[model samples]
Target: MDRITTQAPALVLRPWDPADAVDLVGLCQDPALRRWTNTPVDDEAGAVRWIQEQQRGRAAGHRFAFAIVESRATSSEGRLAGHMVLKNVTPGGASAEVGYWTAAHARGRGVASRALRALTDWAFTTFAGDGLARLELLHQVDNAASCRVAQKSGYELATLLPAAPPAFPRDGHLHIRSRSAQVSALVDATRR
Candidate 1:
């Protein structure tokens, strides 16, 4: 399982490791990251716990979480760039939800979109026979940046979801990309 590193054109998606606690903690310090997702890394202990949770989730075939790393020749090589996950995956189910948050330093660099597309392809391939068909990407309606990332990753707007406070405090948008989709024009825009 640890050997399951996904190679994207510009990023590497690997499982979270204990040694990444410091960087994860630092990434969580960015207010925007904290504001968008329920990050578990507030400190080193929390980071370790979060990493362990990811490990257990992976072992149980429930969640597939990855620590995004830069692989660009000119990029900050090996730097922790973001977190991405395919959650709510049910065996023999047709769909699952995807989520991610780019580190403050990694924002505006296409980190989320690249990592998302790469891992999405991985998930579809890995679960090809398990009936997995669509990966849903949801973000609060106010998160314009996430919207752009979703579009750039080939996920099209599917619907609007009403807010459920204390969890999802804002109305949200649901984007879905089917396993058979061709890379979209929005994704082509990102490629340029």
Candidate 2:
């Protein structure tokens, strides 16, 4: 698996490490996060398992999970701020879904939005040759914050999926960014 990094003005998105388990456990304890995301890091062991799963996904080329950390001048710097991932990569590699959660302390700081933008841009360019043409971000309709993040990251609201059993038990909004020729041409024509 290739290690990838994306730097933004305030944050750096990098691959997860086993050492992040401590912070991951803390993040999972946030009530807001637990409510909005299906985070499984309830204990040290769960955190370890989570990190291991992330590694497995990366090795399988099915997911790229990044730890969002604050950038500092020194090597020993800022702690874990959040996490963002591109998952559900299609067989042809043309599309993937993005998901993210911000730690309690990182809320209202634009961390999620910044990380999302950096990851989205990196994924689009870095994986273009591997058939990555589009990215999708879905959030439950009530998650206004996540919707804001998606919009801020340049994803357009595509559709509202009906409440489906098993996966989406509630109505969800799907946002998408496309690199397809048709979409590009449309964007270009609109700019002219």
Candidate 3:
């Protein structure tokens, strides 16, 4: 399947573009975002490279990286809120990993949670035919806030990956949300 576009009340997730470099750099400046995630707002050059990589990833079909942005802003004045990506998508495509962050100012407003839910819904719905079995979230163990977000989004803690993966700076929580479970939970919520 091709990359998808997801929208929520506060934000829209679209394919990343080169023009997003400036706002993306600003969003990555939050130390909290950088410390736990690989996102670094080092320089314009870095942003340029990231934009290029997003394009390359899309072309290669290994990833889908979106530019999380506000819905109301004109493109020229729109802020780069952050990003959400679905990576390591399988040939069966039923499984994928999600990662996301919001700008420092956007924290606590449920942006990340909403974005995660939106993406999860899309992933399960759109990729179900591809054996889309499950989706997972990875977060540092000390990041209680993120853990809460995952819980709120209906992901259950699956394991404590003892060793930090090469890309992770430290050991963390590995949470999983299976498609059938997610659908059942959503159905239950709507019935109440």
- Which candidate has the top score in lDDT? 1
lDDT of 1 by residue, 51-160 (tens): 99998988889798988887766763478889889888888999998999999988997778878887787888788789898899989999999999999988999999
Where model 2 places Cα greater than 4 Å from the true spot, the runs are 1-8, 180-192
**C-alpha TM-scores of all predictions:** 0.88, 0.87, 0.88
Query: Model 2: per-residue lDDT, tens digit, 42-130?
Result: 89999999999998998888889988888776763488889899998756678889899999888887888878877777777777778
Which ranges of candidate 1 are over 4 A from the true structure?
A: 1-9, 72-77, 182-192
Clashing pairs in 2: none
Worst 10 residues of 1 by lDDT: 1-10
Clash list (residue pairs), candidate 3:
94-131, 94-132, 94-133
Clashes of 1: 0
Which model is ahead, 2 or 3, in terms of lDDT? Answer: 2
Overall lDDT per candidate, in order of appearance: 0.85, 0.82, 0.79
Local accuracy of candidate 3 as per-residue lDDT tens digits, 33-146: 887788645888899998888778878866788877766644522566768888887678667899887888778878788878878887788778789889989998889988
Return the lDDT, model 1, position 123. 83
